[model samples]
Target: MRRLTIWSIPIDREICAGDNLGDLLGATGELADGDVVCVSQKAVSKAEGRVIQSDPEHLDEAFEAALAAETRRVLRVRGTTRIVETHHGFVCANAGIDRSNAPAHALVLLPEDPDRSARRIRDRLRFAWNLHVGVIVTDTFGRAWREGVTDVAIGVAGVRAILDLRGTADWTGATLRVTEVCIADEIAAAANLVATKAAGTPFSVVRGIDPAWLAESSARAIVRDSARDLFR
Candidate 1:
């Protein structure tokens, strides 16, 4: 009896540095209660002026500096591929410095503070429409030993990123020992299906979720601590 709807809302303008993304989003269709907005990480980064130019023929000094600046620690390196831990505790390739869809010889870094960005967007939407909703900033990431990539929530605001069903009875009357669902991440993945890179879409709205799960929380709550991390 549960239902949800995901739709991609395209912004046709070329986003630039110092652009007011809050205003840009507000200009879109009016938001409603329980609507969760998923934004592309590249869009946020572009607006934040987090782009750098690489050399034309070879990797330049800027590339190395960027890699070092964004990476907190190197986890693994095979040939030219590197898996690093970002300062935000995200484990990804090259600290999530993306070059796709950017201008020639340029790369886009992750938002400076994704959680803060989400909060700012959430607050702006509330102020504009007096609507209580959630915002999630998403990025594509490959799974360990898995082919292809899936979108995940790197930032969240005004919503609980996880649903802790531990100790809750299941359909068979069995208690769930450890069944925490990353709600925001699931929403991001669904939205990403519509906000495809080749489709020229970078944002989506997800509807029909439990608003009770909408709270003032950041995606940091979903991050696994280093102490509990089994993979390097």
Candidate 2:
């Protein structure tokens, strides 16, 4: 039987620009070999100074400008919400910008290169702790037909983003097709069970992942190319 365990690590202090996230997380002393670390996107953004000031007096115009700056193309607009493609090729609401959980009069933008951000954190941890682990940067995203939101992996390192099971045989001895699993997103969602948005728990550790899944990977692999995307 495969078993898994997950728990949150509370960041004792607010993460600010230029903060060393690797050092801060390492200080938590909760990580172990083979543990997958799920970090909130807000924490990474704050640390990386990926924030922009929004004028409160003209917030709507400021927001629109920010949205335009971050957006690659506008796909849908309903009321004040926008579903658009970002420069990073992520299709999400408002280009993955967040007004909540940000410094006053500021908006947090997604990391410039999430895959690279994940690698930096992974490498830093490897150097600091001498432990091999996977790192995932997570953000909340709404599904096309689903209600509400769930955390998904926007960045991944030292972990397989997708588990392709197309040729695998099931218990009934049937060949499986089109059964690729988004491992990073699923892990991020599971971590959200403990790393609640308002809990100040920006980090979570998922243990007991299949060791075979630990390898060089990035979340970009999870994005479906437009040529194959039917919804867009």
Candidate 3:
């Protein structure tokens, strides 16, 4: 039988710009080799200074402007909500500009380069703790036609982004096809179980992942190419 364990790391200090996230997380003294560390996207954005100040009096206008600035193109619009493609090629609502978990009168933008951010944090952890572990930057996203949101990987490092099971055999000796799984997203969602949105927990650790899945990969690899995107 296989077992997995996940838990949240409580950080007493508030995350701010110029803070060394790797250091803050490592201070928890809970990380170990073969573990996958899930970090909140807001924390990464704040640490990387990917935040914008919105006018308290003109918040609506400022949000519109900021959304326009971050968006590469609009795909769909329903009332005040927009489904758009970000410059980073992510398709998300409102350009992924999150007002929740942000400072007053401010918005937290997605990291400029999430893959690079993941890599830097992984390197920092490796240097500090001498432990090789996977890192994932997570954000809450709503699924199409779904009623609620779930945390998903916006950045990944030292972990297999997807598990391709095509051409593999399923139970009862059936051949599988088109069965690729987004393991990173699954892991991120699992981490969110412990790191709740209202809990102010910005980090979580997942253990018991398959060792073979520990490798370099990016969250961008999970993005479907525009030409093959049937939803677009």
* Residue 143's lDDT in candidate 1: 77
Best by lDDT: 2
Model 2, span 58-147: residue lDDT tens:
766777888999998899999889999898888999999898877788888899999998898899889986878999999999989889
- Which prediction has more favorable TM-score, 1 or 3? 3
- What TM-score should be assigned to candidate 2? 0.97
List ranges where model 1 is wrong by over 4 Å. 54-59
The TM-score-based order of candidates, best leading, equals: 2, 3, 1
Off by over 4 Å in 2: none
Error of 2 at 224 (Å): 0.7
Clashing pairs in 1: none
What does candidate 1's lDDT look like per residue over 136-182, in tens digits?
A: 99999877989998999999998889988999999999999989999
Q: Model 3: which residue pairs collide?
A: none
Better of 2 and 3 by TM-score: 2
Residue 51 lDDT (model 2): 87
Give the range of the ten consecutive residues with the poorest summed lDDT in model 2.
54-63
Candidate lDDT (C-alpha), each? 0.85, 0.90, 0.90
TM-score per candidate, chains pooled? 0.94, 0.97, 0.96
